[model samples]
Target: MMRTRFAPSPNGPLHLGHAYAALVAHDTARARGGSFALRIEDIDGERSRAELVEEFLLDLQWLGLEWDGAPIFQSHRLPGYAAAGERLKAMDVLYPCNCTRAEIAAAATKFGPDGPVYPGTCRNRHVDPTGAAWRLDTGRAMALTGPLEWVDEIAGRRDATPMIFGDVVLLRKDLPASYHLAATLDDAADGVTLVTRGMDLFPASHIHRLLQALLDLPVPTWLHHPLLVEPDGRKLAKRRGSPSLGDCRRAGEDGRAIATALREGRFPAGISLSQGIHQTP
Candidate 1:
């Protein structure tokens, strides 16, 4: 059975951009007669909110999307990440970094997709276990399942590779799994086969692919859809104060208008009468 997920960070509400991602995953799963699911990706402990998580679920349900299984939340799975990190550490693939955010910024000038991209500060430095974020050692690079070519039924085949995303973070100092580590682990654990998300995350795919290879997990087929950009071409972001799905629902918008707005982008995807989510028991 094909499986896919709509994992959203609960740090913020489901904006229009997220709605597109949900629609793509929801439609594709139904089209292929596969299972659709949801995963709460709250790897960052600082910003996650339970209310926003509720909003994400309500919004997806309102949009007529369905899930195949119980929602898998990352915060509750810290043990799995710790286990995977232990494996990589056993192989000397990880090292603790004592460098602070400021120090890393000073060492690295050019920034990659996720900014500064870490200078691998403690990749070779001996740091006390009491402090600092851990970094993955990439000196011994591992290859992926394939050359990373995947077809997005909408956008065609992509040839993106991992070089752009250098040594990634597997575990944070405070003991949280980085997005890469948590997402890869959850995808495999949940049996996901197709991953449809915004193109903004295309660069991160390489990082995720690397984790998948190391953990001996199946790398899912990817469909990197174009992001829902503002009129100025800037991609939507939760921090940008973009309206949330909860906002639409409160205004009493129906599902059809919300979906059309999501697809066309002519206007915001407000809630519609026909497409709103019916509460499930």
Candidate 2:
């Protein structure tokens, strides 16, 4: 059976951007006769709030986006993330570094293209004796020898390659799991075959695809829908306060009106969404 999820971080109120994404995910899974899962990505413990989490759930429900199963919280899955990290660490694919933001900035200025990109300066040597964070080793360019190809339901044929993202951090010393690690692991755990997300996440697909390889997990078929952009061409942020579905509901905006307004104001060209976008098996 096909399964998909809309994983959103509960750092703030659910704005129009959240509404659009939820609608897309719900509509997609329903049209496909698949299971829809709600995945709460409150990975950032410091920033994520329970109040915001409740609001997110209520907002998604208000937007008419119901799910088939109970929600999965990444914050609660620390052991899973840690286990995955251990597996990679044992393979000598990860190393520790003590570089801070300021130090990394300075290094970026001194180093070139991929050089500034973490540089793996701390990979071979102990740059800092203490306060080190873990990093993925990309010193020797990661190569994947396989017929790696997945059909994107929206964008079509995405030929995945390991060299695309090189090495990516699965966990931080401070945080249990990074976004890439938790997300990929959750998909594997939930048996999610279809992944529906915003276009902004497309570039990061390479990283997740690589994680799937390293962990021997099934790579979920991707569908990168267009982001909910504003008139100024900037993507909607929670701070913008464009009014969430719940907010609009309180303000007397019917579901039909909200949908029509979004189609008219935010998305022109009538938004050709995938009712049942099939992927190549």
TM-score of every model versus the real structure: 0.86, 0.84
Q: Relative to the unseen true structure, what is the C-alpha lDDT of residue 260 in candidate 2, on a scale of 0 to 100?
A: 49
Among these predictions, the greatest lDDT belongs to 1
In model 1, which runs have C-alpha deviations exceeding 4 angstroms?
143-161, 264-266, 269-281
Q: How accurate is candidate 2 locally (lDDT)?
A: 0.70
What lDDT is reached at residue 216 by model 2? Answer: 90
The 10-residue segment with the lowest total lDDT in model 2: 272-281
Q: Compose the digit string of candidate 2's lDDT tens values, residues 59-110.
A: 6666556888788888788898888888987877777777776777676534
lDDT of 1 by residue, 14-120 (tens): 88778888888888898989999889987777787887877777888888778877888888888888899889888777787777778877888667777786766
RMSD of 2: 4.8
Model 1: lDDT to the true structure? 0.73
Best by TM-score: 1
Model 2 clashes, total count: 0
Off by over 4 Å in 2: 109-116, 127-130, 139-141, 144-147, 161-166, 260-281
